[model samples]
Target: MAKQGYHHGNLRQALVEAALGLIEAQGPQGFTLSEAAKSAGVTPAAVYRHFAGRDDLIAECALQGFRIFGDLMNHAWNDGRPSALLAFEATGRAYLAFARRFPGHYMAMFESGLSPSVTPDLAAAAARAQGVLTRAAAALCDHLPEGRRPPASMISAHVWAMSHGVVELFARGAPGARGPYPPEDLLEAGIGIYLRGLGLIPADTAPDPSAGTAPDTAPADPAA
Candidate 1:
């Protein structure tokens, strides 16, 4: 359907941008279609023409946030560093950076509880985002011992839980958050620990000098 003013162009984009601000300032509960339309200088009815309702808009917003987040992870892993574990670490750093930079979007993507009601477009966007992470997990799986590859769903869930635990806790005011550590070292230790438990890391080889002891993943600095 058509929207007011030829110049404003897409009302959907405008509504998404406006909703982001609302999410940032007032959080998901405070995000509303009427408020978004007001912020975008469009009628709420105009927003409805693009979205079925507030839930629909929130679902799209969540999916967009995931797309942005997935891109960050893809970029981090794009370097193709020899160590799949290293690439995983880079992805983690990128993920944390996104959460810190775009807390509103971060919250919307994970905490808003919007995915369940997403339309096909939003659902596809979300799946694409997850596919990026799933690919990375698959890479890490290669280094594991035979018969050790985690089930696809389990691996994706665990890695996401690990990454999100750090970001969400810090975002929600964890008292122990710390600044970003050397990505390789932190991830090496984490991957090492997890892998070692599953017998993935080669035990006979002396630890690489570059390998770092896990610097407390526990959030230490509130300002991270």
Candidate 2:
């Protein structure tokens, strides 16, 4: 039990942190509301003051997770500088990095079973993050003929799916599971092939080959 007279001015944040810890230890469905309260060092009733119920708390955690995830992706994108292709590769690496660095938040954001209809904040945050990929795809498609260019939405979805698949397969830290290459390399190779298929990158125009290894010397701009 928490000590008597404990005063948490930011009990809401405390509860959310505790909930993330619990989610990490046990899957999203593993813990109870009361257990969360106990872990937060607050009374069960105090939790109700911030969240309507277990679902509400879980939703908030997922929402926060998406916000942080979005920010990380945005930073990784760096506004498509130096070159769109290189920036896109950085964004894919960022996705895998986030999954590895914040396993708890990653699981809560992607595996919580909370739909956007039920959590609009989560939906919005996810869209912002995905927008980075959409924009990168748009930049890539710019090189293709207008008639041949794939829809930005399609490109975004394909790249997002590919990145997520590689991260889950190679970066999730599964016991005894190993891949032939690093997650970033796998993602880069897959994106290269996908871009080729879309005709976004011309086959005759020899690929940079070292595009993914290019240094990020673009100007600093958080908005980008």
Candidate 3:
């Protein structure tokens, strides 16, 4: 049992908020209960008055991370971007931006061990975030052939997977040689690639390859 201090005013909220800051600064593995308590200006035992232990606290922190993620998506959707592809791209950029801004929370959102099971709050947050993407995908689907709607779900999944993979790779850095590609360029190319796959735009819509000197020609690969 956690030893409680005589005055635990808003200790629970303070502890959670402090843990969020710590997680955003240090990765999940970096924080300790004693450290959190110290940061909260309370006794180590006081932490347990709110969270069960390190795992419980980590879980709550991660849940909060997902909530933040959902908020990011909601904000992007509310921006009233016109193109479905543009809206989708904005959301992708938002995700990567959040990850860059809060590396700890980003990791915690995906880290299973810290909060392996999705609590009700986390689940709702995740669903809302996904719903944003699903609606965008549905909009894209409207432009697609009837036969393609069923596959939009898979395409949506792939879009998220691609964004997540690309961001994670960029965060980790390359093994050797100088990192040539910029993050924004990589993300734009990734979104373009997925958009092409969804048929929302032509694959040949990529930047003019000939530095404005050449006439527009059909894509080399007609299958695209």
lDDT of 1 at 167: 59
- What lDDT, from 0 to 1, does candidate 1 have? 0.67
- Summed backbone clashes in each candidate are 7, 0, 0
Q: How big is the RMSD of model 2?
A: 5.9
Give lDDT tens digits, candidate 1, residues 17-56. 7887888788887867878888888878888788887777
TM-score of 3: 0.78
Clashing pairs in 2: none
Query: RMSD of each candidate?
Result: 7.6, 5.9, 5.6
Give a tens-digit lDDT track for model 2, residues 112-214: 7877558667788888988988988888777667888789989899888897788778877862157878777788788878876776654434445679554
Model 3 CA deviation exceeding 4 Å by range: 1-8, 24-26, 112-116, 171-178, 205-224
TM-score-better candidate, 1 vs 3: 3
Worst 10 residues of 3 by lDDT: 171-180
Give the per-residue lDDT digits (tens) of candidate 3, residues 108-179. Answer: 677536443446776777677777777766666676568766465676687778778767677454321234
- In order of appearance, the predictions have TM-scores of 0.74, 0.83, 0.78
